[model samples]
Target chain A: MTAEIKWVFLYSLLTALATGLGALPFAFLRQVSTRGLALAESLAAGLMLGASFSLIAEGSHYGLTQTLTGGAFGGLLLLAGKRLLDGHDIQFGEIRGAGARRILLILAIMTLHSFSEGIAVGVSFGGGQKLATLITLAIAVHNIPEGLAISAVLRPQGASLLACAGWSIFSSLPQPLMAVPAFLFVETFQPVLPYGLGFAAGAMVLMVFLELLPEAYEKADSENVALWTTLALVAMVLFQTYL
Target chain B: MSSTPILSLLVAASVAALATTLGTIPLSFDLKAKRRALSAAYSVAAGIMIGAGYLLTLAGLESRPSACILGAVLGSTYSFWLRRVTGSKKFDDNDLESIPVEPKEVDRFLLQSSFHSAAEGAAIGAAAAVALPLGLFLAAALAVHNIGEGMVLTHRLYSPQATSSHPNAVPAPLLWPTSLPPAALVVVTKLPQIVLAMGTYFLIQVWPEFLPLALGFTAGALFFLTLTDLTPFAYGQGRREWVALLCSAAAALVVLGQSFFL
Candidate 1:
């Protein structure tokens, strides 16, 4: 096997390992407070903002017109998705059940979303190994919180730590699942690469503004929330410089 | 060309699977002592999201005046509509104290919320896979936000005993006082917001040409969240105002420092 191929495998493996390692803290420690939670959210917010800017900066090199068109298309897709999901009454806090039927329903809806992300990761790798590796690391670091959130949900149902971890891992299975095909047949799938990036960007921007920030505000003191948000914005700018 | 399609698939799948599973673990934290840590972490994540949206998404569209204007309008309108659709009457402070919650139900709610969050992450990731070449940062930002989100939601839903133990604690119950049960209201109110968020994403995907417009709209939405929603809530209690402001300034400094270094 070529060195690059070996590296790709190792990179993917490491990404997964890092994500799992991040979740280890949540397994044995269960006494997190609201304040602490808020702080963590703030840090994640900073990381995300930095990453988002990096994506756009990179995209701009492609040419203004192409980037603009991509941005517009991405924005519209996010709007439509928001409306459709709204029509279904599945907005924030919409589905809260552990029954087999409910889980199945939620899983089905989530699959569509997860698939989109996986495709994005796959296409990134198709671009170049270095760029792809960095993207993978970013994605993996972000995933740690996701794993913890999923586990928290199942904890009340007598789900063992193992079970919670299993579910958390299960949800992300699509990332690697989609990456392989895109990397192997880069040319054939090249057209979709920009679109993948756009789609992920759109969903992500929307998620942070609409869901994450609002939810954070709800839990915190309003003034504090606002002050912290501004601070968070500044932090994002700082992160951008590094990228 | 250098690798097999199957191997690539395995790599992507492994990463996704690992990220998802790891997300399920419950991180431990003390509710009181770690207030600064919690705030710092969340502020950082929030900073990432805001910075990403403006620098990456917004900056990308700076040259497109028409698109920018359109996106701003659409974003603001959508955000306002969401607020309206998911509106709930504010509960009195006294009302917040009276809401009864069962531990089992809280657990159920947390689980459900977690599932939805994962699904959201999946969707965001999948969409990035198809639309933009540099969507990894956006995905990463969302992932970070989700971790904080999971922590917040889990703590709120699971730790009644801790609250009760502290005599000085003033619990802000998670329920609305109107005839509608708070839990049900929570579910109802959040649906519209979620829809708007997800819908905005899909719209951007189909019309890649309007990426700037979409980003602008998303920015408007986030700005509203920061100014209207979060700011008011954070400062509602008068005593903590100074602390809050200081924390906020500290947060901004952290960002500025990051800009200078890594």
Candidate 2:
């Protein structure tokens, strides 16, 4: 295999293994501070804000009209995802099932989430290793909670801690499987690369608005989130100029 | 040193997957962090996304103006239509509470996570085609990005809907999860993006010339994404409202180099 693909596999494996670590927490702690949780989201938002603004500004370099058009479309794409989610009546209180069933249901959903994350990794690679690395880092950080989530369910069922951790790792098995094909096929996927980029961008922006920020507001100070975002923006700008 | 696309992508995918698995290994630890800390993390992450979106992706895509614009237009229109149909729910921040765990709720979380995965996967694949540098950068960034995302998902799973008796509970305020299954839901959600990304990448391979356009589309899509997804997170109740604006302006100045207003 090419060096690039080799790296991809290594990275994916590391992240998957990271998921298993979630179960370790069940051995000791029962609760995490709300502030800590909020910090994670805010930090992510800050980073996203900086990265996203720079992306738009960079796009503006080509032509104001072109970037604007892309921006508009990006917004629309996110709306579509929202529509899909909203159309379905997904009330947590309304649903009924045993813990095992609940776990399965959630497993199905999260698998899909992991799949998208894997694609995000592959697509970022199209930008370059730097971007891909950053994206990978983001995904890796997020996976901890994901693993914890697995344990949250399995642990309650009296499943062994090891079993819970094993399942957590199992949930994300598709990532490596998918990354291999994406990494090797870069040359082959040239024509539609632009569309893919646009699609990813659109989705990311929407994720920020519809998913992350609102959620952040639920837990922390909006101002703190905003301040952090600005700081991150400046940091990123410097990183880009200097790095 | 020679390798096939499938082999290469598989390797990369594996490494990323490993990161997630590794993250889970830490188990539960009591973090003393508060809302301020979490907010800071989110904002920083948002900034990173902005930077990657522009410096790493959009700037490069400028070469193909026509394709870029077309992609943006379509992305915006489609997104707009979707929002119009579903609409936003009136939400309150204080609605976080524990609720009954059920199978159906878990299903909802998974379905939502999966839909998002499709989008994320396609994005990763598209960016991957740009160049090795960008692909690598995206991989790293996404790895970091998932941490915050995972935390957020876990919170929902851990928190519950307001129980009827609780004074903190609202009839329909924050869209909190009702049970603990959501924790598992969060981890598994990252799965599909790789498959979708690789699949999409394969599709793009059929037509090599569209690479620039593809990149442009990514730019446009990200631009809109920033507006809708990341923007609101930066705003606060009062004095902090300017935080997002100021940060945005600074970013524009550095990135656009004086053409920020233009």
Residue-wise lDDT of candidate 2 within B1-262, one digit each (tens)? 2246556655554444334433333234443342333344445445444554554344433555456545544443444344334432111131222232233344445444444444455556666665544455455555655555555445444443323334332222234333324334454666676786676566667675666556545544444444443444334221232333333333333333223211
lDDT string, candidate 1, A82-106, tens digits: 4455445332233333223223322
The ten-residue window of minimal lDDT in model 2 chain A covers A191-200
> What's the TM-score of chain B for every model shown?
0.52, 0.65
Error of 2 at A181 (Å): 57
Q: What tens digits encode model 2's per-residue C-alpha lDDT throughout A163-228?
A: 778878887776676667766675553433333333333433444444455555666554344334
Q: What is every candidate's C-alpha DockQ against the true complex, given to 2 decimals? A: 0.05, 0.03
Give the runs in model 2 whose Cα sits over 4 Å from its true position: A1-243, B1-34, B56-61, B80-109, B160-184, B234-262
Model 1 residue runs over 4 Å out of place are: A1-10, A25-51, A62-168, A227-243, B1-53, B56-262
Q: What is the i-RMS of every prediction?
A: 13.0, 13.9
Poorest stretch of ten by lDDT in candidate 1 chain B: B88-97
